[model samples]
Target: MNAISDTGAAGFLARFAAMQGRLPGDSTLRLAAANAFRSLGLPGATRGRRVEAWKYTSLQALGGMSFRAGAATAPAAKGIVFVDGRFQSGTEKNFARFADRADFGELSWPDRDPMAALNTMLAEDGAIFQIPAGIDAGLVHLTHIGTDGASAHPRQTIRLGAGARMTLIETMSGSGCYLHNPVTEAHVADGALLTHIRIQADAPAAFHLATLYVAVAAGGTYDGFTLNTGARLTRTEIHASLNGPGAVAHLNGAQLLSGSQHADFTSVARHAAPKGTSRQTVKNVLAGQSRGVFQGRIEVARGAQGTDGYQMNRALLLSPDAEIDTKPELEIFADDVKCSHGATIGELDAEQIFYLRSRGIPDSEARAMLVRAFLAEALDPVTNDTARELLEDAVARWWEGQAA
Candidate 1:
């Protein structure tokens, strides 16, 4: 390592030193990432420096603990499966392993992000997806499972050629206490389309930190949605760049949190070219002592004339102890852009519940109905029947827990 590290970071660096030779990538890149991690350390780990990007959340629980690799198991899945952090099995074509191929991709900035640097130094395996031009891959599934006490880092790449179309359904779930850190990069060529739906259902005692970077070219689209309902601590960060004229990007999601759970959804959308559009809407339902955070930022470059961007974040609190924090920002250098952002935080309307009760509905059922109605708008873009069903089922289970 190039510099001193904190205790928690020292533990990870020690593991990297013990296992660097075994990691299946170019040693130089991994070493550089290690040095980066050594210098950056974990956010809020020691309070030496503050990272505004991580102002609303902390990795205290993950940094102080030690985790081992999880056992891999073979489960029947249509597309691909990752056990722990390795590519255990897959039934899909046009795919490869990151460990076997060593494809780090071009979109991520490990030097700038601590978690990305950590993943870069320790990732053992991942998946590579490629869709050929003019081909329509209707649907595919990606699953991640981490058994007890595991620390897994998986790095993946996704590419869609011109005029290609694909829908990706991602499911993340595990058992016991573990940490799942995955970084993904996606490139959409001209006229390509990619639809992504992520369902994160980790164990209640687990930690999940995920980051995604996407670049969309002219006439291309990247439509994505996330549903987060599990984990003791979770943060999902996304960066989407509209690099060419007429490009479109949508980052939408919802968080259903209860108990002492903490979840953060942060996103940045940049319009780098003229005539680009970006949209985001995130909803949160908090119960018990849960806490939810949303941070959304939009940037319009000086040359990005005719840019259109909009974002809205809303939160519903079921109990007095529940809390929500929201920050919506727009940084535009273009005069010809139409950009706007807003946030709303409140509890369920008592009059609305009363109206529903007058129609012969129970109070719990009435509140549930209103919550579902609020989430329906955020889920409207998920048109795939299978993906929507998965999200619906997860939401239902979370609701059941709150009711109980």
Candidate 2:
């Protein structure tokens, strides 16, 4: 593969080829991923300016950078740290109950060769987290700190044993001039419950691409929420499989962007077994010249009878220059399954603004209040009160900054 300038199709192909070779191994899944990358190819001449239903955010402004491995240092607390895709070890005296392995060999993926596929496609290094059966681990904090002067890739895999429950909090923050491409794979066994909270606060010069893949077993539950408040360009992808009967998944995400920043949230949930259920909600707030995108799809296998799925995406634009694109889809083959999707894009309501002003509230505060109310629908799924409060505070701070 020859290196081409960033603008051409050949350049994109060459980059993909290089990633494939640098990946951990070669597998059928890897080949499929390579094919998908090829299909996406490169952005056209109007790459960022074009309006695509699935791509509301633009990555044109993010310059490419080389990825380098980081040293293995100790983490500050008990949680694990991955800096530039390598594990750093230091323990905060309070750190306890979290599992970490420098090696990916200990992790297991039965449905696919996620390690090889992700490595080849993403060309980044990450870590694995495991929780044993019957353990009610309160909260496992995973932090990605990018100290690398340039871009980096970090991948993670989390496994929860049967009858176990855990809460995972992920914080992405760093100062640098590069992109952060992180992929996380999660497995929840039978009767297990896993809650995931992701907060991203990358620098203005940072570009981010994060992916989460989840598998839920019989009677298992998976709940996730993402708050994207930082970065010049950020995209998060969630792909889940309802692999067993009575499995349930609830996915919610919110993005607050201003200036020239952009964020994209995309997800796909598949029902492979009967009696599975899934619900998805995404809310976005765009201001200045920023852009936001949300794309969600639900698929019911041919034999997946009694499947139930629902999806909704809503966007609020605060400036004429801002843009939003939303797409919600449902593909059901089973006759007994129930699935539906809806999307809405609009500005603040004049009636509500007048109502607030009539009650002596200022315009800026009233707008911020309404925006927070609009977002509550998505934030309600966060099960932890403290975590939820933190998320709300993040949203409030972002809105206050916009108002100022």
Candidate 3:
């Protein structure tokens, strides 16, 4: 690595190590992760867009910040609560219900990525949601907040037993110049189902990086949806492994950005067993000088025959200066597998806009409607009524703010 990248890495490690005593979880693992990060260094910048994975998005915002550890507050299970890394009184019952479970961190998943390792070393506290067998876990709504100069790593884990079902809605928002790194691990057992909806609308001065790891067993299903309309620099990465036959993974997300904002969505779906299915559809609407990125990869193992995988990324550039970069990949070793991936970048339909304007609809409203309709492909998969409504409202707010 060069001197700039080295300085950033060294500073990050030194700060994290100094705060090791204050971070949550076992010290042994934390130290190990920190040590690993020291050797990996930071993911550097793109040399003339040579790095395909990070060609459109820049890490300068995250690298320039001087991050300090923040407290991981407990969450209260109310109708809807916005949390900013603080768990106080009046949330005891909800906190205990989530944290006191016996299988808090039982599942074994290796953290090989440098970003994951950094999260492990700096994570202060996290939320845990475990659903028992044959039961339906109700809605969980939370808003994670961040403050200036405070770097918070909030870890969350959701585990479902056989025949279990649940829905989670988490919104990330905050003010000031902070870096929020959130790590989530979800395990779905045989015949179980889980729906995860995440909304990111943070302060434009903030930096957000989140990584999610999901494992699905036989007859299991995992559906994840993300709506990104915030942060100066944001990256949402998800990795799903279909570990057993008949497992299905569907990942969908939309990124609506304006001004100088940057958002990246990267996902990898692995089929480790036969008869597994994975689907991904992501949409990006960019305006002003914003930039959006999507990197999706699907992998089919040697013996994982009868696998079905599909991926599509579509971006609408609302401004001349706006940009979008999409890289869709497929690595199939199975002979009997079917997989396809593609991306399209275009502008708003001039004819449609003209027709809508001639019909007495304002241009702004017409464009917003078109954007919403375009994004519905990714959002419509969210079956939970409340979560869908909330996401729609968030998208509306973002449009209203960015409307021309």
| Number of the predicted model whose TM-score against the real structure is largest | 1
Alpha-carbon lDDT, every model: 0.89, 0.71, 0.78
Model 1 vs. true fold: TM? 0.96
lDDT of 3 at 295: 93
For all predictions, the C-alpha RMSD in Å is 2.5, 5.2, 4.2
RMSD versus native structure for model 2: 5.2
- Model 1 residue 84 lDDT score: 90
Off by over 4 Å in 3: 1-7, 45-56, 71-111
The top-ranked prediction according to lDDT is: 1
Clashing pairs in 3: 73-86, 73-87, 74-87
- Against the true structure, candidate 3 reaches a TM-score of 0.89
Q: Write the per-residue lDDT of candidate 1 for residues 281-328, one digit (tens) a residue.
A: 999999999999999999999999999999999999988999999999
By the TM-score metric, which is better: model 1 or model 3?
1
Q: For residue 335, give model 1's deviation from the true position in Å.
A: 0.8
Which stretch of 10 consecutive residues in model 2 shows the poorest summed lDDT?
Answer: 106-115
Name model 1 segments beyond 4 Å from true: 1-7
RMSD of 1: 2.5
